[model samples]
Target chain A: MQGYIVKRILIAAFTVFTVLTVVFFVFRLGPADPVMVMLPPNATPQDAENLTKKFGLDKPLMVQYGNYLKNAFRGDFGSSFRFDEPALRVLLMRFPATLKLGLVTFILSVTVGLSIGLISAVKPDSIIDRIGRLFALAGMSLPSFWVGIMLILFFGVTLRWLPIAGRGTPLHYIMPAFCMSLYPIALITRLSRSSMLDALKSDYVVMARIKGVPEFYVILVHAFKNASIPVITVIFGIFGALMVGSAVVVEYIFSWPGIGRLVMESFFARDYPVVQVFVIVVTCMVVTLNLIVDIIYAYIDPRIRYQ
Target chain B: MHSNQDNLLELQDVTTTFFTKQGEVRAVDGVSFSVGKGEVVGLVGESGCGKSVTSLSIMRLVPQPAGKIVSGRILFKNEDLMEKTAEEMRQLRGDRISMILQDPMVAMNQLLTVGKQLGEPYKFHDKVRGSLREMCIRLLEKVKVPAPESRVDDYPFQFSGGMSQRALIAMGIANNPDLLIADEPTTALDVTIAAQVLKLMKEIQRETDASIILITHDLATVAQICTRVIVMYAGRIVETAPIKIFYKNPAHPYSVGLIRSVPVLGQPVDRLFSISGQPPSLFAMPKGCRFAPRCNKAEKKCFKHYPPETWLDENHSVACWLYPGD
Candidate 1:
């Protein structure tokens, strides 16, 4: 088990390094002059040259990437052009908002979605199953942004029950969390229902029933635990997806000053340092989540752990 | 041979039907059998003949959407099992009767360790709580698994197919159930391993004094182990008798054909006998005898009406018009 953990960490580190190398080159390949965008219209050519040399833009791509790696290793992400602050500092300032929203949304979605899925799976052709299927269909059919807007209109504007957006108070979390969870909830429900159905049909489950285990024991102990594998895969996949993608529409709708908004601002301002660090950080976060998922998956099923 | 033992379990006119979108499939058609204390009864049938379905129905383990036990009384020790609530049934399950399913490789949960798996029946019966380590070791020993103390902690993958089957048997008998229904328990094993498993089951039955319902397609196995044999065809019992009587003078044509089909060793090959044609689909069964189409002795009247069961003697019975005179 210790060896497995060490191996996983090493693999994750290598993956992060590969992602960093790719992101560094990919950003350089884009058709845009950072110095040109940074300078004033009447600035002299010497000023542009001086700025390029200062930021190491004048160096070869390989040389610049090498320096970035060295500095990154020492926990120095350099200063952001637009924010006028260190890249790491800027990231730290805005990340908590996104993390908070992502965590709450993930918990809520899994709980509600798994419950509905289990209910539907247990009584496949019942009214509750029909309602769950319809709800899943709606969640999939409607876009997250559209759902957010509708929720805002009904709950915020019309009923005046909650605030429209912003993350300081508890009310700020409601609309954004709902929007973030829509697609994931649908995905989870569908996956859980199918997997649970299959698990319930397994021979072990039949044996459990023959042993006189109650219906709940057959469903919960024997069936549900086995069904969780697919659900867990989807959950971790959604965790990375929700954290990265949940940023765009959710930040816009809620006015949450998270990584999504920061990255967008840096893009418009042509802040090369902030943009580069943001891509690297987001990539690392996603890769790390996937690695954690792999570990958790193995833990839940001992067969995988030993293998 | 009559031990004057109490009937430990009985199935009275049990019919399990599957209502599919295509049609209603009568998987178990009014099948009835009983097991007395410490008696071993064999349910013999080909694939899709409803032996497994009858076993499942007796346990109420039928899949919900399509499979339904339409009519019957499943009585255990004079109490109606069919009328029991889910809770009551749950209480009776591992504690009173347990089953050893076919394909032990799939029967045991692959994810859990052998110890955790064995501990489940104890937990199910509320007989043990927390750290069933010692109990698992004893169970492994009881099933004749080597290195029980260490092997208990191993996963199902670590064990060979035969070992896993023994582990499953251990789980089935953990609660010392009064009745054990083994549904083709050794079907997935090789001939040698099957023999070993059957021997272990017989040994366990003797030690525990538990009644057993052995569901299988092998007549040789029934002959070797069972006291009584119930021969099923197309979801119905075509014949039933004591093991010796059933093998010596099978009254039903299907039973006779099945016994003759077994190849005799050290004999010259002539034309290996086989029951011609396929078993009828349960959805569209013939009006009279189910095996009439394949029976060489089938008569014109056999096509018009179903044959009532005929009692040939005190211990043998046949569902055929040919035996009506008796």
Candidate 2:
């Protein structure tokens, strides 16, 4: 198991290196020049040259790539032109907010999703099952940004129940986190429902019932564990997706200071350092999550062994 | 029918039906039988003949919303189980009565340890005062699973087919149930393993003195462990007799054909005996006797109406026109 974890870490390191190299080139090869955006409008060619030399832009692409890799190994990704701070530091500042939103969304979606799925499976073709199916359809079909706007319009403008944008109190997180959670909730519900239905029909479930296990315990404990393998995979997929994708539109709409919003703003302003670092950090998180998922599988299912 | 005094379980006119897209399929039609205390009764039949459904009906574990016991009196220890509430039935199940399913490979929950699964009845019924793990290990040892101490912690997948079946048997007998229903316990096993399992079941039955309903299609198995035999054709019971009488002078044509089909050692024939024609489909059953189309001695009247049960002896009965009801 230790060997397996070490191997996964090595693979994750290689993946992050690949993403770092790709993002670095993509930004540099693009038409946008960071120096042009960095300088004032009345700045002279000499000023541009000084800024380019200072940031090592005058060197060859290979040399810059080499230096970037060396600095990245030491957890440095240069300084952001706009923020005039280390790009990694700027990314780190926005990390807590995204982590909060992601965690809230994850908990909300998994709880609601598994409940709906379990209820629907327990009494399939019933009224509640139909309603759950409808909820899933609407959740998956509707765009997150549109949902965020509608929520803001209803709760923020007309009803005046809560603040629409920005992050502070717990109430501020309600809309954006909920908006980001819709797709995963729907996906989890559908996956878990079908899987639970299958699990309920298995012989072991019948055995449990025959053992005089209470109906609640039979469904929740016996059938749910058997049904959970696939749902766990989808859940981890959702987590990885939430981390890398980061609900960019929802963050932007809510004016939430998350890595997604930071990446979006940095991209438009030609802040290459922040953008590159954002990709690297997100990639690492996703890779680590995948490894965690593999470890969790071994724990949930006795048949699975990590060699 | 067995005497009421010694009877542990009795099913009177139990009819279980399934409402499918095709139509209402009476899987178990007006079946009645009795299991005496410490008796080993074998319910023998071909596939789709409602043997499993009969056992499920007794347990009140029939698949819901589609399948149900439309009408019946399932009397257990002189009380009508059909009249019992769902919770009451649950309390009785895995306590007074328990079942071992057909496939040992799938009967156990793969995610849970064998010991945990075995301990569930004790946990639910609150029958054990001591540690459940110790009870589980003792049960495993009773079933002859090797290394009972550590094997109890192993999952079902780690155990072989025979071992898994043994674990299931251990679970079934955990509560010292009054009645144990084993549905084709040896069908999925090889010959040697099957014999070992049967031997183990017989030993357990002797030790616990529990009434057993052994559901299987293998006549040889029935001959080995069963005290009495009930033969079902399609959805109805065609013949029931003591094991010796069932093998020697089988009454129903279906019973005769089933016995003839089994190959006997040292009396090898070029072609084994077999009954012609498939069993009638549930969607389209014949108006008369269900076995008439396949019976060699089926008379003209046999095609027009179902026959009533005729008592051949005090303990033997046959449902066929040849044995006219008096």
Candidate 3:
């Protein structure tokens, strides 16, 4: 088990390396130049050269890449041309907000989704099942931006009960977080419901019932444990995806100060360093989350625990 | 056959059906039988003969909405099971009655440890002052599971199919249940493992005096362990007889065909004897006798009308026109 975990961590590091290399080259190959975005439109050729030299743009792509890779290892992401501060520092500042939002949404979606699924599975043709099915249908198909817009319209413009944008107060997170969580909630509900339905039909579940286990214990303890295996996989995958960043559209609509919005702003300003740094941080989050997910998988399935 | 004697369990016209999208299927149609105290009665039949469904109905573990015990009187210890509320049935099960399922692999929750699963019913039904850890280890030892102390913490996957079945047997006999139902317990195992499981079940029966309903399709197995046998064909009980009479002088044609199919040590044969034709479908049953289409001895009258169970003697009975009088 220790060997497997070490192997997984190695693979995760290699994945981040590949991603970082690809993103760096992609940024270099893009049409806009960071130096041009940094300097004024009427700046002289000498001014452009000085700025280029200052940012190491005059160096060969290989040299700059080597420097970038070396500095990335040391947590020294170069200054953000947009923020005029170190890219790593800027990201670290914004990360806590994104982490908080992500964790809250993750907890809510999983709790609510599994409950709906469990109830739906137990009484398949009941009203609860019907309503859950509809929620799942809308949750998966509808776009987050559209959902965010609708939430804003209903809760923001119509009722004026909550703030539309910014991230200081607790209420500020409601609209965007709800919008961002919609797809995962729906997917988890549908996955849990189907898997739970299948688990409930299994012989072990029937055996539990025959053992005279209470209905509540039968459904939750016996049936739900088996049902939640598949649900756990999908859920942790979603959490890992969201851990890196929230939906850009939702963050933008709510003016949420998260890494998603940060990445978008850097892309707009043609700030390659900040964009690269943002990608590295987010990808690292994803890789780490996946490692945690794999460990959790091993914990739940004994077949993997030995491996 | 034991109509006047005291019995541990009695099922009279216990009919169960499943409602599928296609139509309603009479899975267990008017099935009737009885298991006396300390009796090991074999409920033997071909697959889809409603053996498993019959066991499930008795446990009240039949899937709801789709599957229902439409009509039945399952009398256990002088109590009508059908009249009992769900709560009452819950208390009766795992306490007075328990069941072990067919597939050992899927018969247990993969996530739970064997000890936890074993202790579940014991915890609910038995009120011991301390832990059931000692009981679980002893039960495991009784079933001859190796390394009971350590293996109890292991999950179902850690145990082999045969060993898992042993744990299941331990679980079935845990609460000292009056009646234990084993549904195809050895069907998923190898022949050697199957014999061992049957032997363990016999041992458990001896130890607990728990009357067992051993559900299986293996007739030879029934003869080896069960004292009395109830033969079902296409969801109906075609014959019920003492195991010796069932083997020496089989009454029903199906029973004769079944025993004939078993390979004897020195008997030279062209091919194994087989009762040809499939069991009738649930949706479109035969006009009269359910097994008429497959019975070589079936007469014109057999296809024209149904035959009631007729007693050849006090100990043997057959549901065929050949034996019309009780």
Q: DockQ (Cα-based) per candidate?
A: 0.58, 0.74, 0.75
Model 1 stretches with alpha carbons more than 4 Å out = B1-5, B126-132
lDDT of 1 by residue, A83-197 (tens): 6899878988999998898888889889989988998899898898898899899888898778888888999999999899777888888888888888888888888998999
Candidate 3 CAPRI assessment class:
medium
> B-chain TM-score, every candidate?
0.96, 0.98, 0.97
- Fnat, one value per model: 0.66, 0.77, 0.82
Expressed as tens digits, the lDDT of each residue in A1-307 for candidate 2 is 6666677778878888898889888888888688898899999999999999998999999999999899999999989978989999999999899889989999999999999999999999898799999999999899887898999999999999989989999999899988988888898899999999998888998899899999999998899998998898889845776644647788999999998899999989878889888888878788778877877877878777523
**In terms of TM-score, how similar is model 1 to the real structure?**
0.94
In candidate 3, residue A54 scores what lDDT? 88
TM-score on alpha carbons, each prediction: 0.94, 0.92, 0.94
**Candidate 1, residue A170: CA error in Å?**
1.7
> In model 3, what is the error at residue A273, expressed in angstroms?
2.1
lDDT per residue as tens, model 3, B1-326: 65545798999999999999999999999988999999999999999999999998998878887999999798898788999999999988888999998898998999889999888887877544476888889879999999999999999998999999999988887788999999889999999999998898888899889999999999878977999999998889999999999999999998998998899989899898788988898899998898889988889999989898898998788999988783
RMSD after Cα superposition, model 2: 2.7
What lDDT score goes with residue A5 in model 2? 62
Candidate 2 clash pair list: none
Task: Count the clashes in each prediction.
Answer: 3, 0, 0
Which sections of candidate 2 miss by over 4 Å?
Answer: A1-4, A21-65, A243-246, A305-307
Better of 2 and 3 by lDDT: 2
